[model samples]
Target chain A: MSPVETGRRGAAPDPSFAPEPAGAVPVIVSRDLTVGYKLHRERKRLTALRDISLSVNAGEFVVLVGPSGCGKTTFINAIAGLVQPWEGSIEVNGRPVTGPGPDRAMVFQDYALMPWRTVESNIRMPFELQKLGLSKQEIDARVRRYIDLVDLTGFEKSFPYELSGGMKQRVGIARALVSEPDILLADEPFAAIDAMTREAMQGELERFVAKTGQTVVFITHSIDEAITLGDRVVVISYRPGQIKEVVDVNLPRPRFDYDVKSLPEYSELRDHIWRLVKDEALQTAHGAK
Target chain B: MSTPDLSDGGSISEATDPNRIEDTEWTAGEAWERYGSKVVTVINLTIFFIVWELFARSGAINQLFLPTASNMFLALWDGFTTTAPPGAVISGSIRDHLLYSLTNLSIGLFIACVIGIPAGLLMGGSKYVEKILSPYVWALASLPRIALVPLFILFLGFTVKMQITIIALSAVFPIIINAWAGVKTTDESLLAAARVFGASRAELYVKVVLPFTLPFIISGIQQGIGRGLIGVVIAEIFGGSKGLGYLITRAADTFNSALLYAVLLLLVIVSLTLIQITRSLEAYVAPWRRVDKV
Candidate 1:
């Protein structure tokens, strides 16, 4: 292929990354979504998302990237059913989203673990909640397996305070995955870690997602992260966020030790998203509607 | 003056400094000066006692008005085993009064625990409920429990039931309030995490919420126990005729200064023991919270 085609590889002519399956439908669907908050008694609303319609296939990794306060997190929260959309519907596996359910698990930005519990207990929480007539041995085995998966085997007895930020996030990831939900939603899960730690965690999380074949909706401000980790990148506009563009990343599978930042395709995708985000960010900063 | 010897030899040498011994003496003196206040406290108490004993023995004050410490000790010994009389036994003996007061305190505390914990959980968990009831809690807390003795006696009819009500009412509020605050202030994200994990409401309350609130509950109980002791004593003094308060009142009426002093001492002992027990419970429940010395 020519250099021009390779550079423009991330931006397909289709201009929509809503996964088109050869056979199956998306696990999560948001149609013409608008999410917002009511400001005062006058019912003045600040729209966070506007007309965001996307489809996340059963095992696809979709990245939602934009400037801070651009409604990326709000969008994911809506998908998690933590909040209701001002307009439109979000459905998971053909079921209309109403409230939080065990079918969709969330890995929060702050690693929001129960501090009073040990790592193992945190991972076993879903089982306990479902009251799945599983025997003690079965629960223990599942907890042990996830603990191993997260490489926190020996640290199972440690509380959240005793663990480092990255370690705590690892535990949070394990806890989210232990439920084996149909979809995993992460809202800036690695934002709190240092640069080196964040990169390491991102790689680890990418590998885990790749192995599990779980549907993921990851929200982040990092453009390079979006390219490196996502099979498709969804660019969102600032306050009253609407989807600017969706670009498919046709990168090879088992994407390891690959520095997308150095690739021309990566730089091109990054610049395209930057153009859309920078204008919106400037408008928000300058108080332009 | 002869030269000081510097070595074990019999011959005198002029090298030894005689001030070294004086420096050692001064160091010892400074050490004692640093600890001098402890010694001074004992001396001051001894002097006060001597003055008191002298005044008592001289009858500068009437013997019936105030008893010497020796007489108080004798009265305490007699209250345990003997009755002062022309063959009349003391019905309100020291052992009897202690047992009566202890039973009242125990039953009251049990009732307080039964009421305080669940009430605290409800108030703490529900903001609307807490808001509606806060005024009543404030009124109860600020009310002088002693002044309510007559009301309690009137309502409950001067029985042990009246005394228990006084003690429970006095103690339960603090525990409930503290537990409620602790539960309400528990980390919100923790609860959210529990919910996402699919934990049932009951399991969330049992595992996450309760452990976090326990330290506060224990602290409230400690404070409440101290208040409860006050309640028992006040209840006895106001109307009851079976506890240490009754014992002291009767002794006071007959000009039995020695007996009155002895009963007052017993009351102090009971209060001290209860305080010590609560403190130990605090330490036992939260040993992980203790800071280690370097």
Candidate 2:
């Protein structure tokens, strides 16, 4: 079936779509998360984050926007169970993260698709990791389904090298989705793509979250992107980052392309985020050593 | 635009027919021209042999000491096809000696590879291992391995085992050092990606590290094989009953220059064949190297 038809069915209010209380929980919860790194030859401690508490309700689209090295990546890594928070605890579905787990898939800034693997095989990597006892046919079926979802039907056999920047990110997205993770944490997933392709990807991601009801934590520098894709935008301060402001985007559901940026609410949200981030971005430019 | 000069009489001949002008075409001469270099190589070898034969016949050196190129080939043929002079049997025939030498070379090389790759991986994998082993490996690798022939015979006795031991010892360091360096130099980011994907330690080695280090290891293996062959020949010359090295030694002792030259020719052929095989294998395995067309 077509993606639009599939989206209409998925986003439609179905009784079955409600969270099953037994397994479903808040996708992510972080309490006073502090991440730090040991500084160079001097051996002084450098704290990248301080007492950051945040939680995303299941299916919420959250965006973390800040200047470079604002500890956005460090925060996401904590959530993905790659980085251990020095001070606070992080739980995905009430289980404290120890290390990288299959339940939380990460979309890295560089799109971390294995260079040796083809698009289809890259998407199937999670399945390989799972070592699921399913037959090859079953694996192939799920692979085809997700490949179609990302609008990459025929490009399966092509290697990552053969793809454009945007297509590689789509393959990255497809890889993250194939694992069926409750929380998808992306670190500047679209920032690497060209402007036109980034816009298209942003739109595609919006539709994807709406359809799947999968909680997403996207990190980006683009203010409009933050305002557009996020259900709630979390603005972070410069080095030794802390939560500056958490602005709720109460724009209408099923965000249409024409009405998206043109709305008054979108402008107000954009301006608010800009005010918070502008100083930090300027601080970075002014050679803040 | 006026047709740019496609006009160096480039035999790729779409230009010759107006209707087929836009289509790609292969000229007959071009196909033959591609094979021309191989024919030239054969002609070069022929000329080289002719010069060597003319020089030897002109008695530039003592005739007994320096046989003509044709005489060397004849000596080799006579070693195999003809009976020995009355009451004198050649210590071992050419085929027997060549086989014995080849067997020792092959066995030694196999043992070297078996030990070297894992040792290299371990040294490469940990900083502690590298720190401990780096000096020792470098020291061994830099040693004049040919000088150890007598030492190998003393330790292992004058047997094939002694020759094999010398060969293995000579060859092992290159493979180990290269393998270690190859693994150590693999991209850290790639490993991080694998770790984040929840790859097990074994999977990281087998899938991620091994493939990346393969080219380096292959180079090491080729070097080791060549070194190992030299070591075997040297060891056998010191104390061997039946091998190419023994034949060369016996001939030199008796001043049988023609037989010595013949055996040397055979050794050259064997070594050349081995080098060509390794090179072909390297090209086959690393097709990603842009220079290798096939």
TM-score of chain B of each: 0.74, 0.83
Give fnat for candidates 1, 2 and onward, in order. Answer: 0.28, 0.12
lDDT string, candidate 1, B134-248, tens digits: 7888898889888888998889887999999999988998898889988988877677667766656787788778987887898888778888988988898888767887788
- Candidate 2: stretches off by over 4 Å: A1-25, A38-46, A114-121, A131-137, A150-170, A190-199, A221-228, A232-238, A244-256, A259-289, B1-94, B126-132, B210-216, B237-294
**CAPRI tier of model 1:** incorrect
Candidate 2 — which pairs collide? none
- Can you give the lDDT of residue B178 in candidate 2? 89
When candidate 2 is compared with the true two-chain complex, its DockQ is 0.09
**Clashing pairs in model 1, backbone N/Cα/C closer than 3 A:** A129-B198
Query: What TM-score does each of the candidates earn?
Result: 0.71, 0.74
**Model number with the top TM-score:** 2
**lDDT score, candidate 2, position A7:** 9
Q: What is each predicted model's overall lDDT from 0 to 1?
A: 0.76, 0.77
For candidate 1 chain B, which ten residues in a row score worst on lDDT? B5-14
How far residue B197's Cα lies from its native spot in candidate 1, in Å, is: 2.6
